[model samples]
Target: MSMNPITFTPIGVIHSPHKSKEGTPIQPSRLQRSSGEVEIFSEFRPGLRDLEGFSKIFLIFHLHAMQESQLEVTPYLDDQTRGVFATRAPSRPNPIGLSLVDLFSIDNGILKVGGLDILDGTPLLDIKPFIPDIDHAEGIKVGWLEDKTHHFRNHQADDRF
Candidate 1:
């Protein structure tokens, strides 16, 4: 088998108070008070049209600070090692992080948002409005996470990842 390389150019940068990976919340739901801004490039400014009507937006970004990739990792919240896809660990085949953030406002190309769990200066790939009717499901299976869901509320990103 063969693999082909792909390239992606960041459309923006996410500015957050989390300068380092340590001590940052592992998920956006845990970072209720953390605020940040997404500075979209001028070329992508037109994409923000009519997005303000939504209460939340999905931010897809690159884990720029992650040093290496791993297929199996012991995530921040758990001591047991799990496959990369099972957890939101930064080390993966593609270091992409997705967070649903509150849409405070949009001024020109900059978007003010809250509930940020990403590291400062993370490269932004794309943004999409959160539409409950389309994105939400009535019943979902969380697989191995079912047992650990209770602990997620207080989980913070440790140095494990």
Candidate 2:
């Protein structure tokens, strides 16, 4: 590894109706009506040119509200403790969150999206077009998340992390 600290600056900020962390959905797919907007900084506006063609986009953002991180955590759906890497717990070594949201429209530097599960003002790190050909798989193992995933739709986050 390079003995240098890597750094990232926010290219934009996310705006959502979910103001706090306490009640936000754990995953984007769980909240179909949760819509939000991503405001890209003016300097990065040109980067949004061809992105409008894609129906979905991956929002790579920082969990700015996270107070701290733990190596192991008891995740939202399960009662058992798990390594941070094995779960999508917000309290991670790196407080980064990735969500695949539906891109409804893009106007100026603002992108309107649905299926958003982020907090009010999360800092966006990057955005990538979601190409179905490369992003999806027909059959795959879900590890320990198999049985727990069925409960995600009705569950909302709390301060447990």
Candidate 3:
């Protein structure tokens, strides 16, 4: 298939305590109780209607800080080098990032979220409600990550890319 270039206008920005990726948690699951704010642009405020009801929301953002792309990466949880698509390394062709965070409340055009693992001032591309009935799966195969997730809570991101 032919590849096509796509442009995305960020609708918002993410605000968190993490100023750099070096010490940031690699995933939301690694940072319990972490809090952050999502400030939706005024023009997109209307799209957030009824979003407060959801317990979790998927924050799709751009990895604007990723300076380069890599095809193979040594994942944070593993020592083996693997294809970039198989890992969640920030360096990618598109540099798009996604995280499922706990939705606390929506006040005005800002949303309070928990367990966020994104960097401060990250561009927010989109937000979607997470429904367990449709998003969660049973007997899911994690491939190489099967037995390596036990220590995610203590792992921190480094300047590997």
Q: Which candidate has the top score in TM-score?
A: 3
Candidate 3 on 1-161: residue-level lDDT in tens? Answer: 97789999999999998999988888896245669899999999999999989989999999999999999989898889999998888999999999999998999999999887799999999999999999999998888888887777767798886
> Which RMSD values do the candidates have, in order?
1.4, 1.5, 1.3
lDDT score, candidate 3: 0.90
Per-residue alpha-carbon lDDT of model 2 for 64-107, expressed as tens digits?
99999999999988888999999989998789999999999999
Worst 10 residues of 3 by lDDT: 25-34
Number of clashing pairs per prediction, in order: 0, 0, 0
lDDT of each: 0.86, 0.90, 0.90
- Which whole-number lDDT from 0 to 100 does residue 117 have in model 2? 85
- Model 1 misplacement above 4 A: none
Worst 10 residues of 2 by lDDT: 24-33
